[model samples]
Target: MSNADSSTKKFASQADLEAKKTSFIKLSDNAYAYTAEGDPNSGVIIGDDSVMVIDTTATPLMAKDLIRNIRSVTDKPIKYVVLSHYHAVRVLGASAYFDEGAQQVIASRGTYEMIVERGAQDMQSEIERFPRLFSGVESVPGLTWPTMVFEKEMTIFMGKLEVRLTHIGMGHTKGDTIAWIPSQKICFSGDLVEYEAAAYTGDAQLEEWPATLEALRAMQAEKLVPGRGPALLTPAQVNQGLDYTKDFVTTLLQSAKESVAAGMTLKQAMAHTRKVMDPKFGHVFIYEHCLPFDVTRAVDEAQGIKHPRIWTAARDQEMWHGLQAG
Candidate 1:
């Protein structure tokens, strides 16, 4: 079947789209994280004077659920909303936060630039790639632009709460950042740490992923809100999340490198990878959506490509066909 046909098969029905809603999981005192049935995760921190929301879902309509969840806990205004990365599914919902009186929407300098350069393209690609996540596409006003951009790291004080935004290194994306609460030992790892989910590495720096995880380990977090899956409540579970992420990246890179060294096509590489990864990570969230893209990008990077190619709708179709053909 053609890629266009695959698109029809993948998203012809919006059954999955109808299931997105906010799930309030309390991480600590005066702190909670909002996760949809499986949408992008958002965090809420209620300080002495105001509030800070970590990530906004994908659309204003989707963010209303997060807003409603926050209202249940406190009436304090959302003073800040932090973007963990530049992915449209994560930041496009910033407008909802703005209406809630969020004083600043923060991201790293590289992430800010990415939003300007490729955010629109990414927005289009992702909407098609994961239709369920962008349920109310019309609700998105425009590309999500960051108001406050940081370089290496920035610590913002919301009343007495210290929210340390740190650029540990490039892993998931060029400008990946994590929100670390030193006192509580809780780290809101963007896509850097995934729990029970496949790590999406289309724009990932696979070589640098292990080191980024190492930097995260050095922080000794007792609790963490990973990019996906359930929140890690214990240090052991946090470490498990980090380890699983590292293992997936490492194995993917190995499969790609080996397949390319023997002159195999991207499809053959994916098949080999599927054989190796199925018993372990095939059950993870988005494992199928992420693996083909992950392995395809890894093969290109292993063949000496420096930067990841821009993912357009046409390219997505092409890649989808390649996967289906195999």
Candidate 2:
């Protein structure tokens, strides 16, 4: 396909310019979810002494609205910023929390390492791929570094409430973290689980993803705030989210493995994956946008490429043209 056709179709989310209505659903007396339709979702944990913000939006400007929503309910000082992962879309808005007097930024040690390695490239690549999501990219101060890093697990106390942040194996990314409230039976799963949305597996650990989901199930969280989609309030909805994400990962990896076994090229593998996955996940948000990247990573993993290739802006177009070409 020519650049004209590619420009129109590649990263076509710019055409999706309609604003999404944001919702702040109270999951528990101390926990709330700041979800905007299918956009990246954030979780709020209100503590007796202060508050904790999970997965700051995309930019400070965008986060100001979330802060406003938080203020609408409680004026507690925003004391903590918990990064579920190191994705730019998730952690870039951290400055807003800091400005609100956030005491410390928290993340898994692996996430901190990821931020130092390919964070810049991922930031540029993601912004270019989904301009609408980063509505105010200009407000992003810089790479968001974590103030506190934990190894395996860390239990934080927000007064009497305990917020357990654990590096729950690897699924979405190597540094995937989840915030669990044992008393409330609520968990804030980062990109490890996405509800009613396409699971972006561009940098995922596909082989280990299912096992990670099993660990989440072992929690039996009654309520969940997924990375995207609305908050899952009921046990059935939470299970649905977990099952949907697991199905997506397993199917993609299995298809890619089959393609590799048949000695199919990346382009052919993309087609094979589409035939199987599109029928089921085609209607989900960003399905078209995510498939190419997801298949590329799966193919690499199947071929024994352990680490995900860094996605630069230029590489994104090259891959899109290769996959979407007529």
Candidate 3:
């Protein structure tokens, strides 16, 4: 097959310019979800005297929309911003919250370390791949640094409400954090759990990802606000989201393992993966854009590269071109 027709299928989401309608749904009395179709999602927890935002939108301008929604209900101080992970799309919008009187930005130690290590490169890489998501990229002050960093787990009392933030194993990234409400049984599971969307496992622990999903399953969260797609309002919907994410990651890893064992090239492996992953997750949001990165990382893991390689814009282009040319 020709490279233009085969390798250059153009999964670059820059072509994805259509605007998506944003939704603000109240999952419960204290919990709400700010989602825009399949774009990045944010979680809101209105405590007795304050508001806690989980995963700020991509930029301050984008965050303004969320702020408007927050104002629609409560004008309490936006006191806390919790990062689901260190991905630029999720954390970069944190500065906007600070303008709303955000007192603290919270994240896992791993996420903090990741930011110190490769946050700049990751931020540039992400912004290049999907410019539409970063609607106000120029407004990003810089890499978001968490003021409050925790280890395995940390609990914050939003008055009587108990918001538990935990480093729930490694699926999406080293510092995958989830904000859980014990009283309401609601969870804000960053990219670790995406409903009807592709999980970007480029910075993932492929071998251990499934187990992490299992750990999240043990939470038994009745309502879940995933990183993308609609909120999983019911326990059954939560299960489906977990299942979808687990299936997506496992399929990529298993396929990469097969391709590597057969000594197939990266481009060849992507094709091999499509046979299985496409049939199941082909129609999901960002599937085409994420597949190559996911497959490449899976291949590295299969070859015993435990830590995921940093993805820079140049490297991304090289990989994309190589995959397409082959």
lDDT of each: 0.83, 0.91, 0.91
In what order do the candidates fall by lDDT, top score first?
Answer: 3, 2, 1
Better of 1 and 2 by TM-score: 2
Going through the candidates in order, what is the number of backbone clashes in each? 0, 0, 1
* lDDT, residue 65, model 2: 94
Show model 1 residue runs off by greater than 4 Å.
1-21
Off by over 4 Å in 2: 1-9
Residue clash pairs of candidate 2: none
Scored by lDDT, model 3 comes in at 0.91
Q: How would you encode candidate 2's per-residue C-alpha lDDT over 153-263 as one tens digit per residue?
A: 999899999989999899999999999999989999989999888999998989999999999999999999999998999999999999999999999999999999999
State how far residue 322 of model 3 sits from its true place (Å): 0.7
> lDDT value for candidate 2?
0.91
